[model samples]
Target: MKVSEKWRKVLRRQPRYWIAIIFLSLLILLALFAPLIPIDPNQTDVANMSAGPSLQHIFGTDEIGRDYFIRVVYGGRISLMVGVLAMLASTIIGTLVGLISGYFGGWVDNVLMRFVDILSSIPWLVLVIVLSVLLKPGLVTIIFVIGCFSWMNIARLIRAETLSAKEREYVVYAQFIGEKHSKIIRRHIFPAVLSTLIVAATGSISGAIMTESALSFLGIGIQPPVASWGSLLQNAQSSLQQAPYMAILPGLFIILTVYSFNSLGNFLRDVTLVEG
Candidate 1:
């Protein structure tokens, strides 16, 4: 038991865990204190336009001389929100469809699976791009577009998990004891599948961030005055010959953020599998 406890502590205290925690901590801090930060993200200094990184403007000024660092920080907040809230929206939708389909089976399962199949047939990025172009670009629009299409994969994963879990004795006993469908789902099946759900959700965040960036890159995502990492990148395309920093700074942030999420998701998948 002493050895078991020691192993448990070691498992929980991985170095990658510290890195994920620190990355997420700074992201949260940047978002919460964006307005209070010293730099003016939107205010442009015409004289300083296209300046490279310096103590005066740490991440350098963009073509319009806005503070790149400050914009990137705030863009982190917007992109993070789209990833998180959109994933939560997808989770709720996918979990419900999967639970009902897997628990009841027969015709219900067929219908839900077919719906997911139809959704999966559509190219997700193309669909989002079309939708973003049609709906007018904004934060909420991006979130909606992402959540609407991203739930199918989660639904399939949850359905597979539920099929296995329903055969387990606890689930059988719960049904035999006359527990409600919702109760069984909330209590028994959810806990069984939740570890995988967390990993899927973490991965979804990275996907959503990339999708939003792509949309912004195409000029159909979050609009100007309101920044996103993708929107920040858009500014540099025209000035690439003269001001490459416009593209480089936010591009690095996007890469770092996505890599952090991917690494964290892999770590969580391994950790959660061990726990299960």
Candidate 2:
């Protein structure tokens, strides 16, 4: 069956796929239009500091009386951007390294796999923290650091898949047809890898978000004045006793977003397995 047809069939069988897509889409839309939305995330009113949720501010005001709702909304943009861009970076790097290692065996495979193994052995969070210390904490640094650490799993997964796929009848047939190595890998192998990559990308998004948030919470991520969910939570930490909602609001959003991505990734992985 065509991949698209199989994908459609799988999606039809899983209601959560639609739910996840819809929820994530709404989040992306909200983030995309956040700037245009008539809400002042930064405008503070000391008079309203520590206020509870009201009709005017459904999420209430922070310690400094900035509209919590707008801050959260803007925070979503940073969180989502970090997650997506990091996922892309990791996926591309991992996919290429895996494809190369698997498609061409011998020393290439040995060296690459050894490097991956060494990376995989390290404590992921610790490694990220160290990297964060070495490089200045910013959007780009967070994205690249998270991606660099995250790619090991993807590399191993793709490498195994490629090793198995290279010996398949279709691949052998392509080889027999005198196709160039690159063409065979791109045309035949890549399609198979693409399915797994989609699942990996989705999973990576959740991880990236979590990693970025954790770093930001530790004051090594998106800096002050930038409203990432992590930074928002950090800002609220001291005020937790006075304004419990300060911590709860952004935390809830982070949990929900991560859960949504994880659910979507699992659904895609299951569907891809069935397709295979």
What is the per-residue lDDT of model 1 for residues 1-276, given as tens digits with 9 covering 90 to 100? 354554355457666666665787788887988889877778999999888889998888888888878888988888888888888888888888887888889999998899999989988888888888889779889899898789898898899999999999989998999999889988899899988888888888988889889898889998888989898888789988887878887898888788888877777776654532
Q: TM-scores across all candidates?
A: 0.92, 0.94
List candidate 2 stretches off by more than 4 Å: 1-13, 273-276
Name the candidate that leads on TM-score.
Answer: 2
In terms of TM-score, how similar is model 1 to the real structure?
A: 0.92
Clash number for each model = 0, 0
lDDT tens readout by residue for model 2, 29-105: 99999989897888999999989999988999998899999999999999999999999999999999999999988
